[model samples]
Target: MRRVLAALAAGAFLVTASACGSSGDSTGSDKASSSGGTTKVKVGVIPIVDVAPLYLGQEKGFFKKQGLELEVSLAQGGAAIVPAVASGQYQFGFSNSTSLMIAQSNNVPVKVVSNGIASTGVQGKDFGALTVKGDSSIKSADQVEGKKVAINTLKNINETAVRESVRKAGGDPDKVKFVELAFDQMPAALDSGQIDAAMVVEPALATVKSQGAREIASPLVDVAPDLTVAMYFTSTSYEQRNAAVVKRFQAAVAESLAYADAHPDEARQIVTTYTKIPAAVLAKVTLPAWPAEPDRASLDALQKLGQDDGLFKTAPDLDKLLP
Candidate 1:
């Protein structure tokens, strides 16, 4: 079965991460109080594992403490999110670094406000990987050269990370062919020999691995470990108009990240609650690192990867995107 995150990423529908209005944090001042009582911040989000912190933040009352209502407006992909934030339809959004970079390259003015998920760095612990059928002869990234590789999307994080891994493995990145396939379909494609290998993310990675697929490389980690997969962002105008509100939101998110790292079991439960992943599978899923802030070095490497891949005409100003 397809993961809820994947389903949501394909235009499912909106579900508010926050509950009904609640009392403010009495001990602490609500920074968003300046917005007149409470602020409703709608964000375009995908229900993937990477976004667990957002849901956890809601459950922990982090956003409520800031007097902000974080409404999770589900969009199919980051392709849909950029325009929504740019048009002022949403106050914030969650998108991969590459997509946001592409938007900024087009001068969309969306700035990343905080970090989302980061790679685990340890092999077999990260959420993304290059995998082959369990019986395949492919033993390393080097073997993937001249082979057909499947990725959820082309010219995005998956391809970029896989390309980096191929290069690191002393293989010609150009020799590989890439085809797009939905995450859930990739395992079958691998099993049926439709694709030689696949660059997959979590829940799907968990899915494929459980189906006897073997991971030969962790591209996201190999290229840049603890890589920030996605982030919360908003238009530059919105950031300027709500500087205090933005700071408060970031603070709440940072708290949530720390909370998640400190409470792995509860974090897993929160993820299950929002995503509805199978209990058995959820227990085995590899959770991502939630850094309080975006890793600058990783972002730089990601931007450079895009530039090298010719996805961007010029390297984006990384500093401009950070909060």
Candidate 2:
């Protein structure tokens, strides 16, 4: 995953190069092809609980109502999706706020269009958590000092959240050894004592809980109340050339988010269509908040954390990045 993120950071240059070419018109046409009054667009997404609203929205005919047809492409993570969207392979992509900030700071041509997911702002009940084994000596984030901790990606949102957790618990985050492990693989790794703790989100969080993992902290909530964890975004070039389509998409997604947030059962059911999570585990999954509008204050708090952590090349210009 580290190698993948490194590749993604390096691929930012490819996006910059592509943005400089005369392919904008052609790419825009390919991105939103209209036929019989319907615009077909490809979206790159991670097959996780956070993206359940998009599948639900499609099933609920929200996109269809906007005359938009979605071709959803599943990827490993935002690292892969960001570059694909910027290179014009996908019209839009879903990614965590930090990854998007990193891209924008590096001058990658991307613009956030709509909110994706947010922390529920309730400790021990949030969708994501910092967990240790059932019988581990570590009972709080402060105890994680000098221990091996796992995050999905190094120097990304999860890492930032975990560090904040440690700091809030009065521990020096720098003293904690961080490791990169995918969400799916974390359950077994934690069970087998491969790592002392893991920062995980649903349905993996549910799986970890099923294995008797003890939740020590809700790291995302610790970062800020209702932290805007992720958002749906498009390349700047695509947004520039396809304003009408982007507007339609933003509206459709906002409607989708409201519908899913209002109907949690439907959201959980939709996760089955894209992911292989079990029925029992799916029931145990905690759904994230899906507000129609991004929380600017929460984003500001997150940006400050990222800046202090040196996660960006230059501070992201939220005025230009936000819709």
- Best lDDT among the predictions, by candidate number: 2
Candidate 1 off by > 4 Å: 1-36
| Candidate achieving the largest TM-score | 2
Q: What are the lDDT figures for the candidates, one per model?
A: 0.76, 0.86
**lDDT string, candidate 1, 221-300, tens digits:** 87676788888888788888788878888888888888888888888788676554687877777888887878878888
Q: Which stretches of candidate 2 lie over 4 Å from their true place?
A: 1-30
**Model 1 whole-model lDDT (C-alpha atoms):** 0.76
lDDT of 2 at 263: 96
Candidate 1 TM-score, true structure as reference: 0.83
Weakest 10 consecutive residues of candidate 1 by summed lDDT: 12-21
TM-score of 2: 0.90
Q: Model 2, 140-182: lDDT tens per residue? A: 9999999999987778898999999999999998899999777
Positional deviation of 319 in candidate 1, in angstroms? 1.7
Question: Could you estimate the TM-score for every candidate?
Answer: 0.83, 0.90
